[model samples]
Target: MKVSFLIDNALREAVVNSCIGILLKAMDIECKLDNYNFFYSPSGFDFFDRTRENIDLTLFPSYNVNRTPEQLSRAIRTNSMMVATHAEQIINSALYKEKLNTSAKSKYSKQITSHFVWGPFFAELLMTHSSIPADKIYITGNPKLQVSTRLNTSTPNLSPSKSVLIVSDFSLGDMDDERWSQFKKRYKANYNTPIHRHYYEARRKLVNWVLTASERYPNIHFKMRIHPGEDRAAYELLKGTNNISLVGDRDFIEDVLDSGLVFSYSSTSLFEVLVMDKQVFNLDLHDLPEERKGEYFELFEWVNKSQFMDILRNYDEGKVFYPSSGRKKLLEKYMYGGNQKAVLRNAIAIKDVLENRIAQYGFSDFLVHYRNLCLSLVKDKAVKAGIWFNKELGLQNYISTLANRRKEADLNNPVRLNPNKIESAYKIASGIVTESEIEILKNNLYEIRKEKDGIYIDF
Candidate 1:
């Protein structure tokens, strides 16, 4: 059997996809990895679909449930099955609840939970929301965990090393600062507890704290790894006096696994570290206000002075703590309260559904459908916006090839100001009216008629 993994980014696809490839290879199945094609080939998304038709199966991994299951199901088409691994709680949280609407909510809640899904706690979700038969859903252990074990076993003589992993948040509106500020104001007024504000304040304190620690412990190295989606400037500003090394885009996960201790305030990467059996110190400095404390703590691990200092001292001694035997224990006791061992255990039980089972639709079929829909929408939006701007600015006439000829005539003869060319360029450049942004060029002709104004622009 042969399989192909289709993903957008290299660093983003490293963990789970790598693990699945290794596992399938060990089973004597040919695993081919497709990467960097998106960068070199503009039509790579199209080429990927053609290639998918020849594969035995293709895995489309996703963490969030932003699109409907039907949308997901129809996107990929081929002779092979499409598999996805989803983490339920992360999607069900209040953060995602706001991003989805009533129809999207019903679709995701209904069909997504039914298919070949893998995550630590999925049983409860499946029991409550899914309508698909139980046998179809497989709980292949998180490939991240399976792959991490190899690192420990491969090198029995590995020595202790000090490393700190930094992760960025999915802060509300890091894309546009103006919109982010507005969100901050509304959140402050209504909820009285802004999540991003707290996260920023904590990050500020932690960066300084890390700098102090790095200075004091010269032997220990510090590594800052920013999230892919985070605003780079915000991260830089947060690093007050910290002159530590930064992790490049591709080195994030490898660094995390190799670290002696992981220090993070609110990143989900901390959970990944915990799964690696490494010591994780969640630096919860200030207490949340009474009313918001309960919900806020769910997103972060509460770290007091005693626990923080103890973990720091322990790291200096070359000792590491796993905290719990498995994720079930760690999550059940300290994180979300439950006997979630069944959920964890079930996740590892089914791994062969993709091998012999028939797919409702193939990978190529889904990819072509999704790719066409997306490209069409993107092109339509771009053209419509360009037309609207062109018309509103009154620059329509300047867009014609004739306008360039008029400019050349004036360029050759410095003594003569060509009214036609001047007017055409002006109309094209000015943002005036939708009917003929071309009209502004006419205004330029008026400027040129005053021949004494000798400043000229070449076409």
Candidate 2:
């Protein structure tokens, strides 16, 4: 049996999925997994020399599959049993009404064999809104948050020195056409303000506050981890302060765990810190719409720039107040099982499906797999030929036009992963998991394999 995890965002999902990959491998399943970019993108053919045609099961990166037609069409065309496993777990009523409704009512959702959700909240949304069968909804916690407990204890995640980490969650940035269209509608409805103006206005204020704070406290180091959606170059001017460093490419989980103090404008990542019983601030520089506050308001300490500065001053002086004891209950209420063995739960669910797997027309699928393998070789050759011709011959103007024919920019997610990285992540996660679970996989550690044979792909 073959399974493919079509990852949407590599940085966020890859590590946790690595945990899942190992579990599936232990089940004696041949798993093909990577960023959906490499699995579906035109340039992806470069890294892949063979394809596993007609996969037994394909787990898409997010439930928002309707947002990307190209990927959706390709996924439907290629896979046998499709599962909608979400990467984005933070869902509010407004967000669900605006974004997820399209996915819920989508034909793709109807075709999906299983719909995996982060919590009961998401499961209820799919059940109520999509009218999907109750049996189909799998309430798996967000994959990343699943491994949070193990990752939290990973000593390397702890900082060597005290540093302040400001998670910048600005709203304006590159978006898919569907989301962009929605943003336009929201912009029109809100009289020219962006869809999430509160995030924009507040994060902007927080940025200025940090710039001044970084100077005022030169001895303290501050790292502004910019939002993945926001353009990093937009904050180039803020990089002048030596005490503050604007970053985009580091591991957010590790950084969050390492930081002495953590703050964000409106990101849900702060909850990961809260899980470790650490203090994190949600800087509400601008008043957030009551509807947009969502369930996290009770778990996180919502404060403004000035209030944050006062807290920071206290933090620097070695005094800080942690989140309330009641936050544990709120976290549990919102996070379903509140950080249980989600990776194991996901692995077990996929395993059960595979164990009772239906027989596909075996011979035809064998032929199809080989055919796809051959076609992958052809695609790889063609991609290499194009690259050689463009770079070697210096024919940019012509190649640019051909490249524009493919959605290269859209396929190019900010973070990319390779087998070595995935393997390394697998090893790291293996170490962090419980000893008994490690014993289960110890015999099969070498069994973990991927569909394609490339180190990495750069689109």
Candidate 3:
């Protein structure tokens, strides 16, 4: 048996996928972990679909609930049992349901054979709202959270904690005029409330507040971590300030571990910080009337810029403490992160499907698969020709986000695939998979394989 994984954010998924690959190898099953672009590419061309081409199962991280026909079409083309695990777990309950409602509820949800969830919170959401069967959802704790905890323990001697880490999850209206125009028009047509509009206004207010605060207090060091896809040109003012420094690209845990106080709004990273038992202040940037905040905002004692400064003054006087009880309760409710390692639990679930212990209900039949394959072959020639022409003309920037998903995808995601870092995480072994059996194969591309002495690249 052979299994494959679709790895998007390499920094976070690399270790988890590698560990799963090793576990499957122990079960005498082959595994391949490939980037989304690389996995689907045919002979180094664009818009091709060769996923699970010669493999049994493919674990695609299906982050969004609503998928277009074009999106679902590729899954049909996989020609193998496909499993889905939502990479970005929900933060905003209101927006999450909307994102889940489209074709996912009507088609894509049932098409997937297995759905790995973080816990009951998401499981219930999928079953109730997305038309996914209860049996299909596996409540494995998030692999990212599990790997994050392991990374935290293995390497603790990081830089001294900074005064404050402002983690931004805001996608502002500050992109190139064309993209921003499209974004606004889409939101205006679809949303009931002006969701993006409110976020933009609040974002400017918060940024200005932070800039003002940075100048006011020279002693308190401030660090800003923005999403990887964001245009950095918007943040050029920070270079002039002595106290404020923009964070470099690194794992989310590394930034969190080095920060004394956490401040964020509208990001799932808040859950990650809570899992680490760090006390985080919810930055109240909701400036609109009847604003619907995420479920997480209720957990923190939110404050404005002045209140944030007061808290910092209190922190300097040794009056701050981590919230252990809050962390425990929230983790239980959302993560289902019981004592057992999440990575192992997730691997076992995948292994069960590979061994035929559990059966999947794929939406497509054999005839549908054959038709899709024919369409893809015909489609690829045109895409390949267009790509060749576009590159020659140096018109790469015009490509939409879909094709922009290649290695250099500017999704504002900072974490990247690094073989050495993955080995470090595995060397700190999560029990079932030992350190000796797993090695990251770094020939031309990073592929983690399990063997005593050989790197398996036969696929």
Candidate 4:
């Protein structure tokens, strides 16, 4: 059977979904997955349409950026079935809502015959907001379940008791609570203006917390693994600490499997950690929204205050909380709708809905178990063509340019924006903003007004 998958962009979060495409091929279905930015303009539709036919199925996960299932469905004329996951991730952002609404208005919404949601929350949200039917809801566990590759990477040689893993919180570049507060006072006293966005907002402070926890507890060593899409600067800053080690590799499930405990700040990684049935901990910070506050607090048996001393004092001896034995049954009811391999199950379900009999299928015929293989092999040429980018290029400034490459390749460099270099480049340009070098740029420079002839560098 022929199948294709589209993830729009290759951000770390989206790459996590590549397992579905891989699994399809393993089941002996032909598949193609690519990072095509289908939302740029109308002309972009052809790239997606060309791969639609002569295939048994199409999987479109990670469409959070701009494209909608409706838009792509109408462009492709295929008798092959279509199955989509992560339907809820699309509307979770304020930015995506605008794009989704626009696409829905243009007749794209009506064309999508089948789409699966992340969980009950998203399933309910979509039905309430759109004309979609109830049968469309399928609790397909994410392909991330297949993320056990890391577990295989380390085996009898690695002792789980000797290692502990900490997955840091999700962060916006401008959302540092401490940095934003300081920037506000500095801005108001000097410019008499209030700062709107948080400045110095990387996950740097959490590294300190990690160090403190490590120092306090000597029994189990600590390993730090930041989100894959995150830049190297966040990890580099922590490198100076003697005790902590950085794991920047892309594999997620395997890394967690090798470790005994995981500490996260409201990351979806918690789901995978639970899937592994390992001890999980949650850290509390101040920048997140209220409703989201402590949402995952109940999930972990372990919880800690944000204060360094308090965490250091209590963390080592703290006991981890586990969801009840019945918890998995409860979560699976809403999360997986009984089928853990939701993508595969959803395709089978779709075939059942369209036809009648349900036949057994497998990915072995189409996909080879090159378990030792790296995705870079299949993705390298595309990376050169604008698919994936690495954070290793510039350690100091990885946050600024780590994943920005339209395609994945090593040749790309961060467009340097040093103050002196900018001044020279702008002096010769026609309408550039290099008026003065002595400028106090806020986090969100575009939001600030120029009092004098100060130059604004929009990043």
Worst 10 residues of 3 by lDDT: 450-459
TM-score of each: 0.59, 0.78, 0.77, 0.57
lDDT (CA) per prediction: 0.45, 0.63, 0.61, 0.43
After superposing all C-alphas onto the true structure, candidate 2 shows an RMSD in angstroms of 8.1
Error at 392, model 3, angstroms: 9.4
Best-fitting candidate, scored by lDDT: 2
Error of 3 at 348 (Å): 1.1
Candidate 1 lDDT, 132-243, residue by residue in tens: 3345455333444444444444434232556656555535325354565576443222334455556566666766676666666666667776665455665564344343
Please state the error at residue 326 of candidate 4 in Å: 6.2
User: What's the candidate order when arranged by decreasing lDDT?
Assistant: 2, 3, 1, 4
- Better lDDT candidate (3, 4): 3
Model 4, runs deviating above 4 Å? 7-29, 36-56, 64-82, 87-108, 141-143, 146-161, 174-202, 291-302, 305-330, 337-344, 350-459
Q: Please write out the lDDT profile of model 2 over residues 1-459, one tens digit for every residue.
A: 878887665667667877887777766778766667544233535334333366777787654433443344344446567677766656556566444544436454555667667667666666676666566666666557757667776665455665888887675434444665677565322223344555555656776788878777777789888776686765766877877887667567777777777887677886677776667877777876666666656666788667877887887777755667777667776565567667766776676556653423334334544554566567656655665666778665443345545545544445666676577677766765565554544443222211121111011
Candidate 3 lDDT (Cα, 0 to 1): 0.61
Model 1: weakest 10-residue lDDT segment is: 448-457
